[model samples]
Target: MSQTLDMFATDDYPALTAGVDEVGRGPLCGDVVAAAVILDPNRPIMGLNDSKKLTEKRRERLFDEIQQNALAFCIARASVAEIDELNILHASMLAMSRAVDGLQRAGESVKPEFVLVDGNRLPKWHYPSEAVVKGDSKVPAIAAASILAKVCRDREMCELDKKYPGYGLAGHKGYPTKVHLEALKTLGVTDIHRRSYGPVKALL
Candidate 1:
């Protein structure tokens, strides 16, 4: 119910289609995640906020609602290797681009006229894009996308936890938390970790 969120809800625009948001760019292990969401303006969800601001349970609930209600949606990722090769920023953009491409591939006839991305840096893509600072908190569509990306990346990290038992991936979700740093000190880097990252590279 913030003023910024309210503004996006009321903004008049043609073909206000999918919004884009990304996650995991800063993680030392795991892929860069992105999501594209197209909200139904007629049926806006209540209590929409940035994924980081919501509880896990709330985000899960919103994720389900978004998948069910949105006209089209897609989640995508750029692998840690890809992130290393392209650098995190470009890799994040590539992930977003892949999400947008997936939406098109799924037969969503209407292309987004404008893509509202959830950060100050805009991705280089064919479609027109606007980078909105704090967009996930301000725009419902971006919020939905953020939830999807976070959930998706969290799931991936959990899977990695099973593969690398001592890494605490599930607990930290591969971020550079104190616990994660401790784990890195003990276990060193895994194949899934971005060796190019400063903390991870310092281990080398």
Candidate 2:
């Protein structure tokens, strides 16, 4: 017998429950961005899926849709300095916590009663929460959050690309791609490059 996973387990949660996700965890540069989204059950969004599985244009479109339709959403990030200081995993948790805090602040009247995080780990926080592996693909709210975080970080990378000019931050979004590695070897590590990471650490 095939075992089927329940994708909508969090649907029974309180109305104010939020979905949380982070982006840029695998990137060798740029801040890790996280988003918390409290979706309005009355307003369901279409075409929500993992940000990586969607085309850039599709993700952008859904990003706008999520911003306009979600009951509340907040984007937050841990900067390069924070990443270097605390390490990427803890920094990512810091970013996720900030995102949840921001969402609560933005929607002051209606705080989240619960939280569903995308990855297998949960940030140390007071909210009742559960971590769902690959939640972005299975949970609509997580999918929305993923798109928001991804788009926000990608835009920042584009700006960094303009400033840096050679690292292909815009194309690879600071990921340790072939072009990015070549550029790093040629131009050296920049301020935004995560010094704790192996490739960038080697260069330094």
Candidate 3:
């Protein structure tokens, strides 16, 4: 008989819980960023919500607060090359895994007794974790992870916009928006683009 894997084996909240989330999966460019946050129950930061639902000002504020208050937090990413080579979904998993691993090595690392990952898929890892639908909004730690990953990715895209101005990366953050597509058509694909993506591959 084959063994069964129970994703919710660790559903009960533990004293040390790490929430994992990824950002940039929908973008045609930029690395997929992931964050693992082990929030300190005693240092809770209110107003936690899915990063998308939060205003820019609120996200920025929470970003700092999460870093300051989390028992351990790590932001990790799979680069454009990794995304192109492994494909976005696998790359996202890799980034998520890396984030959790980083937390184990964090300056104040607290090995999580359980993990809650945002979205419907959980990365294959040794840690006991569950995949939660819309967990970013439902779980405080996941919300904090989303905020950190989003803010970090947004800032990186803004910096890249300075290097490659025509894509409006700062505004669209590398998503395949009309402006970004138009810019890609006129400017041609840059090195930062994921060559494996259909839109980018067509251009090449």
Candidate 4:
């Protein structure tokens, strides 16, 4: 674990620092989900990596392990309406902030002193934070956050598929795929869709 971490560890984030990341940003439907995680150095989980790079089985296994082992974790989301109103970028930031703020309420710890977020932009908040380009692969906490958010969002997408049915939300995960585009034209757009998105907007 030490050997692998050496290749991807953050500069010098103190313990109890929260790592933040979001998922479902590129999906044409559903809320953008985010998660914040503060790992317990004493109870480390293995095989942490970018959620996109991990198999569903591994992510599912780690998902439970992280919740069981982390000092704190919180998952949050920005709704489709918020996406339409704020734009995806700001909405994603809002969700990320909500996640970190949630940790204060949800975690055993009072608060995280520092935050490391995946990607290049940090949410507008009071916390001391840095946005790492690929922090999901670089930081263990971020990787844990990545898994939580992805699994949570993907599960929601599956449930949403049941509700919305014909859009094939389960298979495409709400991405603007060829099948999704075809469904949009044939069956029409649902309220779950981000009306601000190009394909969705055209239909509206």
The sequence of per-residue lDDT tens digits that candidate 2 reaches over residues 1-204 is: 001223566657888889999998899999999999998878888788888988999989989989988999999999999999999999999999999988843447346889999989999999999998888888888888999999999999999999999998889998889999999999998888999999999999
**Cα lDDT tens digits for candidate 1, 1-204:** 445577665266545567889999778898899999888877777777899998999888988988887877889999888998999999999999888777742465447777888888877778877888888988888888999999988988899899999988998898899999999999888899999999999999
Error of 2 at 199 (Å): 0.7
Error of 4 at 151 (Å): 0.2
Query: How high is the lDDT of residue 51 in model 2?
Result: 89
What candidate 3 gets wrong by more than 4 Å, as runs, is: 1-11, 104-108
- The whole-model lDDT of each prediction reads 0.84, 0.89, 0.88, 0.90
Rank candidates by TM-score, best first.
4, 2, 1, 3
TM-score of each: 0.92, 0.94, 0.92, 0.95
| Per-residue C-alpha lDDT of model 4 across residues 1-204, encoded as one tens digit per residue | 424444765557777799999998899999999999998888988899889989999999999999998888899999999999999999999999999988843535458889999999888899999898888887888999999999999999999999998899999999999999999999998999999999999998
Better structure of 2 and 3 per lDDT: 2
Given candidate 2, what's the lDDT at residue 180?
Answer: 95
Q: Rank the candidates by lDDT, best first.
A: 4, 2, 3, 1
Clash pairs (backbone) in predicted model 2: none
For model 3, what is the C-alpha lDDT against the true structure? 0.88
Which residue pairs in model 1 clash with each other?
none
Give the clash count for each candidate: 0, 0, 0, 0
Best by lDDT: 4
Q: Which TM-score value belongs to model 2?
A: 0.94
